[model samples]
Target: MSDHHIIDAKKMMITLEDVNKWYGQFHVLKNINLRVKPGERIVLCGPSGSGKSTTIRCINHLEEHQQGRIVVDGTELNDDLRNIERVRTEVGMVFQHFNLFPHLTVLQNCTLAPCWVRKMPKKEAEELAMHYLKRVRIAEHAHKFPGQLSGGQQQRVAIARSLCMKPKIMLFDEPTSALDPEMVKEVLDTMIGLAEEGMTMLCVTHEMGFARTVADRVILWIAGKSSKKRHRWSSSPHRNQQGPGSFYLR
Candidate 1:
C-alpha cells in the first residue's frame, strides 16, 4: 500500500514546457510550464478571458499550440498521427456542454470508440462500458439517449463515455459550469468518486469550493499576458489561497 501511494506520487503523466499559444497575434498561454503527477487532482481557476480552458485544450490538441510542446503519458505531441492518436486515447476529455451523441443510445456512445479504435470485441467493449457507467452512477440509464436525461445525468454519461476509452489521465474543461445549481453536486460527487479511485485529473473551473476541497494542487492563469511576462502556476503545498481576479488552490 505504501509503495502504491509512492508510485502514484512519482508517476508523471503530463508535462508542458514553455508552451506558448497564439490566436494569430493574440498570445494566449505565455511560456507556460506545468508537470502533473499521477492521481493528483489539479484545479485551474481564473477570469473568463484567462487561458485556463485554452491550456487544457492544448493538452489533447483540441486547440493546437502555436509554440512549445506537450507530452502525455510518456509520448510527445508531435506531427505523427500515430502519436496524436495514442495520446488522445490515453487522455480522456470531458467538455462543459456534455457533448454526447443524442442520436445514439448511451450504450452506443460508450462502446463505439472502444470497439472501433481499440478494436475490442463488442461484448468486451460493452462490459467495459457497463463498468464505467456503474462507476459514474448512470448504469441504469444505459439504453437512454442524451436528450432523455437531465443535465447532470447527461454529464455523468459523458464521463462514463470518457472512461470507456480507458484513459490514463482525464482533462475536464469546466465540468460543472453549465449545470443548474442543484445539478452541480451530482457532477462533483461523481468527480470525487473518481478521485477516490485514483484517477489523475486536470480541471479548469471557477468553483473555488470544489478546488479547495478536492485539489492536491491549484494552477492559476493570468487573464492575459502581463507586461509581456508569463505567470506560472505550479502544484503547491496544501495551503489555502485566494485572490481578487487571481486563481486560488487549496
Candidate 2:
C-alpha cells in the first residue's frame, strides 16, 4: 500500500464504550467496549445469538443500541439523523445474503449507491463501479443480472457495490456462510485483497483459516460480552486455554 493509503497508527477508527442493547425483555448486547484503529482487520466470532452481528450492526446504527457511545471516524452515533447518515455513508456493510437487486445488472447494482447516495454523475458512477467490479474480478459480468450469476459471483458483486461507496470501514456479517464450500475461497480471497489494501474491516465470520491468515488480533465473544483474553494468529485455534468460546479476529 502507498503511504497515502497507509492509515495513521495513532488515530482510532471506531470506538464503542459501554455499549448496551435490548430487544424487548432480552438483553442482546451487554456493556460492550471496543476500540479499532485505522487499517485494522478485526473479526467477530462466536456461537449463534452471541451478539456478534448485532454489535457490527450497531456501529452503523442499523440496529440502534439502547445505551452507550459509538464513535465512528469522528462522529458520534446517536439519535441525530445527520450523525447516522454520516456514519452510514462512511461504513459499508455486506450481509450474509447477497442482497443484490435481481432486476438490475451487476454494473447498475454497483452504481446505484454512488449515483443516488453520493450524488455522482451516471458516467462517473459507472466508471467507479467498473473499477471496483474489476478489482473483485467480476467486471466481465457487469451487464448480467444478479440472478444470472453464481452464489460466489453475486457475493463478489455485492462486495464491489460496497467498495464503490469508498467507505472508511467495511463490515461483513458471515459473508461466506451462504456460499457452497467450493465457493467460499473466492470470496475470502477478495476480502484478503481488500485487507492488503489497508481497509479497516470488522468481519463476523466462523472461517478460522481466513481469520488466522488476515487477522491482527482475535477477540472471543461469549454471551453478550467480549472476553478479556486476547488471542493472536500464531496461537493454536483448537486450544482455547481460557475456556470454551468462539474466537473473534482483530
Candidate 3:
C-alpha cells in the first residue's frame, strides 16, 4: 500500500459475502467473497475464464449472482431500482472495448451521462467533461469522433468519461486488452495518475507492472474462486513470475 493511500477498515466501500453465480448450470463463480475500502487500489488478475470479470460486473449489478450479498458504498445490491441506480451512479466502469457512442464527439460522450443522469446543465457538464479530458491529456481531441482517435486515445477518453461522473469507486474490466502494445502505456499512465490521487479502484488486467506500481492488494482468481491475495508491492509473487502459456495475462 502507498503511504499516501487512505484505507478505513471501518468504512467499507464494497463488500461481497458468499457470492455465487452460474450460467445455466455452468458454475462460473462459487462462494466468492471480497471487501474493498475507499482509496485502495486492487488488481484482479487471472487467465481467461477465471471469473475475474464476472466478479467486478457483479459489483455494479451488471451480472447478478444467484446467491450471496453484494453491498456498495453501504447500499445493498438487491432488486430495488433505486439502489441499483445509486450503485451505478456511484461506481463508474471502464471496459476493454472503449464503449463510446459512435456518433458522439468525445466531449459529447463524456457529458452525456452527467447531463442525463445527474441532470446537470449543458454548459456545466461540458466544463466538467473538459476538465477530465485535459487531465487525461486528450482535450485537443474533444471534438473528434471515437473512430478518429487511436486506440490509446479512445481508452483515455473512456477514462475521462468515467471520471466526469465523479464516482466514488472506479471499476476497470480488462481496460488494456484491446489496445496496441505501443498504445497500452498511455492508458496505463492515465490510470496511474488516478491511483496517485487516491481514487478507489478495482482493475481487472494482466498488466503486472501496473499492478506492482499502484496496487495496494493483488487478488488472483482461479477456477471460479479467489486463489490468493497479496499485500504490499514488494511481496507480490508475480514480480519474478512471467512467461507465455504459464497462466500469466495473455
Candidate 4:
C-alpha cells in the first residue's frame, strides 16, 4: 500500500497527477496522483471532511484545483469553459443528496440536461430519459415530481438523469449516504447493475460491502491525500483500525 501502483498506461481512462487544491490558505488535496482504467470500478472510502468529495469534484471541474493535472476521458481539465463543458458531458456525477428539480417531473428532470447541454431534441431526450429510468427501475414514476417520490425513488431518478446523457464515466459522491437505512439498497442495486455493465466509475462512499463486492480497487484517503489502495481480493488486517474520523478512501 505504501508503494505506487504500476498500471498499464494504455488502459488508463482518468489520470490525476500531482493534483492539489486549496480553500483559501488551507491546502485540501496534497499531490494526489491516481489512474483509473476504462471499466474499472474504484470505491473511495474515508471519514468525513477528508477531501474525498473534493477530490471527485475536481475530476469534473465542479471545484477548481490550484495545481497539477486532471484528465478525464483524454480531456485535460483546465479553466477553459469549452473544455470544461466538453469534459462534463463525458462524465456524469451523482450527489449524496438527490438534487432533482422539484418543479420538474421525473421524466422532465431527466430530459432537461440532454436537451439543453447536449442539444438533443426534446422528444429524443425524453426517450433517452425513459430508457435510463427503466434501467434504474423507476420508469413508472416518470410522471411524478421529485417531491412526490420517496428518497430512494428520487435518487434513482437522479441517477437515471445522469445516465441519460450517455457519459463515459460515472462519479458517485456518497450516493447512498443521505438515504434512509431501508432505502440504500435500491440505489446501490442500480449502481451495481451499472458496474456489471462495465461502466467506469469512481464512487466516494463508506459502503464497504458494496466496495468489497463491486470495486476493482478500494482506496483510503487520510489527511487530504490517498494513503492506501488495495485490490478487492487482497486482505488487510488493518482495514478498520483507524479512528472514526481518521478517514479512508475506499
For each candidate in the order shown, give its overall lDDT on alpha carbons.
0.81, 0.86, 0.87, 0.85
In candidate 2, the residue pairs with backbone N, CA or C atoms under 3 Å apart (3 or more residues apart, or in different chains) clash, namely: 42-250, 43-249, 217-250, 219-248
TM-scores, one per candidate = 0.86, 0.90, 0.89, 0.89
Question: Over the stretch 1-250, how does candidate 1's per-residue lDDT look in tens digits?
Answer: 2666334424569877678888887878888778787787888776787898888898998888877768788777878889889889998999999989989999999999999999999999999999999988989999999999999999999999999999989999998989998999999989878876889999888776777667776676676432333333335444335312223332
Please state the error at residue 191 of candidate 2 in Å. 0.1
lDDT for position 9 in model 4: 31
Candidate 1 stretches greater than 4 Å from native? 1-11, 224-250
Model 2: lDDT of residue 160: 94
RMSD of 1: 6.3
lDDT by residue for model 4 (1-250), tens: 1223223333578888889999988888999989998998888877888899999999999999999878777677887888899989999999999888898899999999999998999999999998999999999999989998999999999899999999999999999989999999999999989998999999999898777667777788887899754333444433323212222333
Model 3 lDDT on a 0 to 1 scale: 0.87
Q: Which stretches of candidate 4 lie over 4 Å from their true place?
A: 1-11, 229-250
Query: For model 2, what is the C-alpha lDDT against the true structure?
Result: 0.86
Instruction: For residue 237, give model 1's deviation from the true position in Å.
Output: 8.9
**What does the lDDT read for residue 26 in candidate 4?**
86
The list of candidate 2 runs beyond 4 A from truth reads 1-10, 232-250
Residues 35-95 of candidate 2 have per-residue lDDT tens digits of 8989988888888998999999999888999998788997888889999999899999999
Winner on lDDT between 1 and 3 is 3
Instruction: For each of the candidates, give the backbone clash count.
Output: 0, 4, 0, 11
Candidate 3 to truth, TM: 0.89
Q: Which of the numbered candidates is closest to the native, going by highest lDDT?
A: 3
